[model samples]
Target: MHSKRIRAILAPVATAALVLASGAAAVTAAAPAQALENGVARTPPMGWNSWNTFGCNISESLIKQMADAIVNSGMRDLGYQYVVVDDCWMNSTRDSAGNLQANSSRFPSGMKALGDYLHGKGLKFGIYQAPLDKTCAQYFNSYPGATGAQGHEVQDARQFAAWGVDYLKYDWCSPSGTIDDQVRTFAKMRDALASSGRQILYSINSNSVHDKTGPRRNWGDIANIWRTTEDITNEWDTGQTNGYPMGIQNIVNVTVPLASYAKPGAFIDPDMMEIGRGGMTDTEMRSHFALWAMMASPLIMGNDVRTMDSATQTILKNANLIAINQDTLGLQATQISNDGTRRVLAKKLSNGDVAVALFNQSGSTTTISTTASAIGKSGSSFTLTDAWTNATTSSTGSISAGVPAHGTVVYRVSGGGTVTPSPTPSSTPSSTLVSAASGRCLDVPNSSTTNGTQPVIWDCNGQANQRWTFSGQSIQALGKCLDAPSGATAGTKVQIWDCNGGTNQQWNLTAEGTIRSVQFSNLCLDVYNNNTANGTTVILWTCGSAANQRWSRV
Candidate 1:
């Protein structure tokens, strides 16, 4: 996980309006302009990282044991091949000649020997470093050292290649300067690694604090796998740890909008997996895994493989889910619909198959439904194979399931003759309502599922609270209609209420990018006082050409 101290150096949080505006631009130009051709990570890399479970207390013996367990537990044959050692492996000081060295006490036989051992077991080796003055552990745990690769990118790259390093996690610790400077700094290491004559999978953490950079579309040209959000803790929803959003859902929200950036050899990294970590329930873990795989993210497990229970093992070793993740098409899943508690995501596969996920983010069993045509499939008949249970069923087009709360049902849809994928629609029914003036999202306070919660303009996190669906003339979220509240007028704050077909609950999305109240067509949804800060109240005001009243569905 990211250290609290390092996170403090992040630039002031951008308003949701700015985030949504940039995200819109990114999605428009998401086609890979120039991607790294390192010839690695053709599919999302699957492996284990020593961070979520062990943190900085990692050792050579522990890594070796995990490697042994990976093979003995059948994870190796399941495509979990990389064994990564995160921060704190380096000594407090560099050796004579200013060369980085491993802490002798932890790895007495040295990194080269450990790498050789892993290679002998048919696994790859990965290590971590920072481009700044120190690693995260050095700052958070007060580890003695300034062992960074700031001015020694070439030297360190050669050193790691000599040690048989197959992967390098280049982290951004206390990054300064403009985004261009950051890009150049990272690309310098990329070049150095290329010259090292070893194919090292470079994974970078550039937006660790959700800064103003937004989703960097140019990252594909610099690194093989790039971290798209802050570190992930072993929690289900948007839980906070040390004042930072670190839950699975929190990270998922940030990642969902970046689906267009992933391609073969350049995958998105949502940090590492916390599957077997004891912080979440089994249902949540399964959902977490399903979301990651659906997003085409690197599946770097962060749990103790040697001690994983049967349930944990089963979730991690699901062959069907893994197949979707490693699909040769290298396409990430797109959100077909999201009605707060329930969401549907679908990805296109290489063999004329489509992977669909019905996710229930609620607290009770809910019947989520979607159609093959909605997911970009055209078939006379389709075979739906349950990814988890291996149960098969036939369907003409409709796909529905009673998904448990915090659980997901994934299916591989085959027999869809030649797969006629629909053209990307101009507007999705479900979308993040972005304000043109502020660039933030229209959001419900605290992701409340109850009725009568007023909405606001906040930084876009892609959470359920920020997702709204346009059905008929009404805009809805959490299965409730956006209402004008009783005694409605031009200045009334907009709140969500049970859909009653009320005039105040109906809306009309104008071609000019304004959401006008159907009952009061002269009035428009507005950000109170044109404030661009998070938590700004959203109210009804006279329809005008003001930018604050202009909204876009993303």
Candidate 2:
């Protein structure tokens, strides 16, 4: 997969690709780069990037507008600082002295002036490049040519420092076929960045092909954040790769398994976020943000900030979730339990509190509960606070709640019984949503991971959309309360509405596993036409002994 990944850079005109690929200036040793002493990126880097929103269509005006928006929109006050230009910022060819040049038309002010503009606004500037003869973008797209730091790593590093660049995302596009070559190539750039006498947070990108190819290189010793997966799209839970883009939930599943490899100075990056892209439901976006926060991931937003709505802005700037992410301990959360339907993940914080995410991996609203000891906490009583809603509650040894399909409930629980006052929380799934028909589960359509994501029935694939729980006497999924439209007749669609403790939102799961609405006991939960395939619509029908009406927890 790394062989197929693409990006762009600049090179000289005289047979540039051939020259950089000749191994003329290749370093032979395999070691971590010498780190600078500026205390840069002591924790995961918080920033914004260009690739997800604009791709190769970046300009000085756009960059300047984004910098202004971050300050004016209060994102800077919320701890988002860096503005990175990823890929395609370089010209087709370098200058006479073999210096990489910013595309003159798009960046008339030059790289130095642009860096100064960002610095003047109290923000940092970051840039991207490939360690190979060409970037993944150029190679995969079959462009005329591309460039790298292969022959002139030191010169490029010096130029970047001179331009006051604070971060660099060094990708391994079209790199050599061996792991040692990749490591040594990155080390060459790392040492070059250090020799320039500037404190740059060096980010090394791993070859996605080599991600599962046996043992991994020591990227943490040299770079701040190493990419763990391919590009992330606005979708969710898709592992299908035809050299195409990925979704937010799919990326979460990819990076969740690599938690042990993350730490304070170095992190496992899933790639830039696609928030405010209008591709996912609000609930899906919240899950994406919270999961990335729990992973201690580099929160580099990849969306158009200048036009984000209030809800999008609020999710990105959630102070409590950000606090859990930026906590000094910098511990990445790990999955602790998976009982075929629900999965629980927990991260021990530096503040003696544990951040827990109860993920419902089923479709129907089921009771998903977990004890404190199950999450590595040794206590009888604990105080819990929801990060998104800012709601506070206490739990004895275990906490149970009804979550909606494909929803999550994230809470910060203090060790033992030390109750701490906190702010409110938001629409987050606290349990898994399961279905009773054909042993299937409720899920977001097409595995959609965004707000206002609708629920549908799908085979139990253990995805995020299939998670739901019954908390507070309401069927909830994707953080929205499951309800039949007000005064709807039988066979009307059951939709995910705002949780309001209304009668339509309440359901009774009888001892026979039949789910009946409290507002209308005569109607029972039923799959449309007894369809057993995925995407089947669920509706209220008269109670019967039919297989479609016989509900049971799997």
In model 2, state the lDDT of residue 467: 41
What TM-score, computed on C-alpha atoms, does each candidate reach? 0.85, 0.68
Q: What is the TM-score of candidate 1? A: 0.85
lDDT of each: 0.79, 0.69
In model 2, the runs with Cα more than 4 Å from the true position are: 1-3, 6-38, 142-146, 208-218, 239-244, 417-554
Q: What is the lDDT of residue 326 in candidate 1?
A: 97
Number of the top-ranking candidate, with TM-score as the measure: 1
Off by over 4 Å in 1: 1-34, 175-177, 208-218, 239-243, 418-487, 495-506, 511-513, 529-536, 545-554
Q: Write the per-residue lDDT of candidate 1 for residues 213-314, one digit (tens) a residue.
A: 134344888999887666677887654423254677766655665666789988878789999888899999999999999999898999899999999999
